[model samples]
Target: MAQETDAPQAPPSAPTAPARALLPLILPAVVVGVTASLVFVGVSVAAERLQQVLWGPLPDALGVGRYSVLWMFAMLTATGLAVGLVVWKAPGHAGADPATFGLNSPVMAPAVVPGLVLATGLMLAGGPSLGPENPVIAVNVGLAAWLGARLLPRTPGALWPVLAESATIGALFGTPVAAALVISEALAGRPMRGRLWDNVFAPLAAGACGAMTTTLVAHPAFDLGLPPMSHHPHAKDLLTALVISSAAALLGMGAVHAFPYVHAAFRRLRHPMLMIPAGGVVLGALGALGGRLTLFKGLSEVGELARRPEGWSAGQFAAMAVVKLTALLVAASCGFRGGRIFPAVFIGTAVGLCAHALVPAVHPAVGVATGVLGMLLAITRQAWVSLFTAAVLVASPSVLALLCIASLPAWLLVTGRAQMQLREDGTPVR
Candidate 1:
C-alpha cells in the first residue's frame, strides 16, 4: 500500500541519535507493555465470567434457552440500561461518546478510565456485536500517559501514548508485528527527527513485551482453523481474490456510509438511557432474526463457522453477514463502547463462507483472507493493519500475494470515502 502524502516528508540529511539516548527508553517501554497486556487480559476475563452467568446459569435456572429471542432481547435491553446508568452517573460519561472516537483516539482523562472500562465490560458481556479494542486502548493510553508524566517527568509526554497504543495493539492481536504495522501506517507522511527504526525502537520493544505477555496469559489465536491452500496461485486465483475482496469492500462501504445517519437517528433520542435501550431493542430483533451465531464480538463465532463451513448454506452465510453488519451498525450508532474490527472479521468470514458455498472451486482460505482484507481495509482504513490481520487469520504465506493484489481495488474504493468513525457532530470522520 502507498503511504499518504498529506504531511511534509523528512529531510534526507536528518541526523541519527546516539544509542545511549534510545536505550534508556527500553526499560520504560517494557514496563508499559507488560502493564498494558495485564489490563487487557483482566478486562477480557472479567467480561467472560459475566457472560457465563448471564447466558449460562441465569437462563438455565429460568428454564429458558439462553439464545431464545425473548431472552436475548431482554439481556440486551438490560445491558443498555445498565450502561446508560453508568454513563449518566459515572465519571467522564464513559470517556466521550464511543461514536466520536476511533481505534487511535486522543488520550482520555484518568477519571474517565473507570467509566469507560465499566461501559466496555457491559457491552462485551451483553452481546453488543463489538470488540474490546477501542475502550481498552483508551484505558491503557489514559493510564499510561498520566502515570508516565508523573513518574518520569523528564521523559517526553508524547512518548507514553505511543508506547501504550503499541502495547495495547500488540496485546489485542497477540503479535508485535501488528503493532509495528499499525504504528507504521499511523506515522505515514509525518516528518520526524530520526530514521524510521529509531522512532519505532521504544514502541517496538513495548509491543514485543505486550505480545509476549498476552501470549503467556491468554494464549490468543487468530487462525480460524480453515484448511490451507497448498496449491500455488494461478491467474484464476488472482481474479477470484480481486472480485471477492472488491465485493466485500463494497459491502463494508455501505455500512460506513450509513454510519452518520444511524448515529444521527440515535442522537435524536437526546439521552444515553433512551438511545441505548432502544438500540438494544433493535439489536434484539436482529439477534432474533440472525440467531445466536450473529451476536457478540464474533471471534469465537467465526471460529465455529470456519470449523464446519458445510453446515451452513450460502444463503445462511449471507444472512449472517448482513445481520452481523447491521448489528455492528446499530451497536456503534447507539453509543455502544467497543471497536468494529473484530465484528468486521466475523462479517468477512461469513462473506467468505458464502462465496465458497456458492462456488466450490474457490478455495476457502483464499476467500476468507481476501474477504478479511477487503473488510478491514474498508472499515479501519489502515492498510498495514488490514493486510497484517487478514494474513494472520489464515496463517498462509501463499495467500499474501493474493491479498496484496486484491487490496489495490478495495483500497481505491474506500481511500477518500467516509470512515466508520464519526465527528462530534455525528458527521463521518474523513
Candidate 2:
C-alpha cells in the first residue's frame, strides 16, 4: 500500500534587519562612551597612585620589605576595614549585592557610585585578588543611564545599559572588538526580531569611541611581553597544552562549585562591617602564604610571571596559584567590589609557568597561553573572550593554533558546571 504523502513544508521566512540608529541615538551613544571611558580611567589612575604609595616608599620608610608576608597581611587587613567602612556609610549600599551582580547586571543608581569607587580602589590598593572591572562597569552604567535619560528623554531605555556596558568593556580591554565579543555572547540565542549584527551596531560604535578615548588617556598593554613563540607548536606540545590547560580549568571549576557556599557563609553575618574585615584577615593570611607578588588584581604581576617563567620553580608557581585562588574566593565571597577576570588571568599564568617548570619541552608561550585560555574559559565561561585575552597577552602567532586546539578540551571540562557567581536565597546564579 502507498504511504500517505507528507504535506509540503512552507519556505522559511527571510530574517528581518534591525532599523538603523538615527542621529539622536548616535549622539547619546558617543556621549555615554566618552563619559564612561573618562570615569574608568580616572578611577584606574587614582588606584594606581595609591598602590604605588602603599606598596612603594611607604613600605620602605616603615622598614618593611614590600614582599614581606607580614606586610601583605597588615595591608590587606587594613584594606578590608576601609572597604567595609565605605560600604557601611555609602548610599544605596553600593548599588545591590555584588554577589548577585554578574557581568551583565542592571544599571546601579548614582547614589551607589561613591561606595563602589571607594571599595574598588581599596581592593586594588590592598592585596585582594580582584580587579576594578565589575565595580567600574556598575558606576559607568548607572551614571551613563542617568545622563542618557536627561539627554534623550524619549529614547528606548534598553539602549543605555547596553551602550554603557559596551563602552566600559572597550575602555577596559583597549579594544572595541573585545566588547563586541562579550556582548554578542551575552545576547546569543535570545529571542530577537532583528539580525544579530544589527543589534550589535550601537554598542560597537560606543565601544570603538571608548577604546579610542582610553588609548588617548592611558596606553595600557594587554600583551605581557612573553618571549617569541618558537616554530609552530609540535603535536606533543599541543597534547601537553591540553593536559595543562584542562588541569587549570578544573582548578577554577573547584572554586566555582564552592562560590555559593562561601558567599552564603559570609552573608550569614548580615553586616558588611563584620563580614568584610573577617574576609580580609583570611585574604591577608593567603597573601602571606603566597608572597606579595600574589597580591593585587594581578595584571602587572602576570607580566612579571610571563617575563621570567624560568625564575620560578614548579613548587613556587603552584604556591602562587593556590594562594591567589584562595584569595580570590575570599575577596569575592566577602563582598569586595571587583571583577574576577583579571585575577583569573594571573592564576592561569601561574598554572602555565608551573607546567613549563615541570615539563621543559613545552613551549613557554604555548603553555602560558593555553593555561590562560583554560582558566578564563572556566571562570568567565566566555570562549571568545578567553581566546582573545590569551592571544593578546602572548601576541604570538605560533601559539594561537595550539591555544585554539587546547581550548576544546578545556571547554569540555567547564561546560554545564556551576558558574562562579553567588546568588541570594541559596540559588546559584548561572
| 204-293: candidate 1 lDDT, tens digit per residue | 999999999999999999998899988999998899999999999999999999989999999999999999888988998999999999
Stretches of candidate 1 exceeding 4 Å from the true structure: 1-12
TM-score of each: 0.97, 0.94
lDDT of 1 at 404: 93
lDDT of 2: 0.85
Clashing pairs in 1: none
Query: What would the per-residue lDDT of candidate 2 be over residues 1-430, giving only the tens digit for each residue?
Result: 9899789989776476634544456777688788889998998899999999998999899999886877888898888889898898999877677777767767777778888888888788887889888888888888888877887788888889999999998999999999899889878857765677777878888998899999999987888887876577777887988898899899999888888889889989889998999999999888878887888999998888887889989999999998898889889899898998899999998998899899887777777888889998888888888999898988899888888888999999988777887566766656
Q: Tell me which residue pairs clash in candidate 2.
A: none
The root-mean-square deviation over C-alpha atoms between each candidate and the true structure, in angstroms, is 5.1, 2.6
Give all candidates' CA lDDT scores.
0.91, 0.85
Q: How good is model 2 by TM-score? A: 0.94
Model 1 lDDT, residue 236, Cα: 86
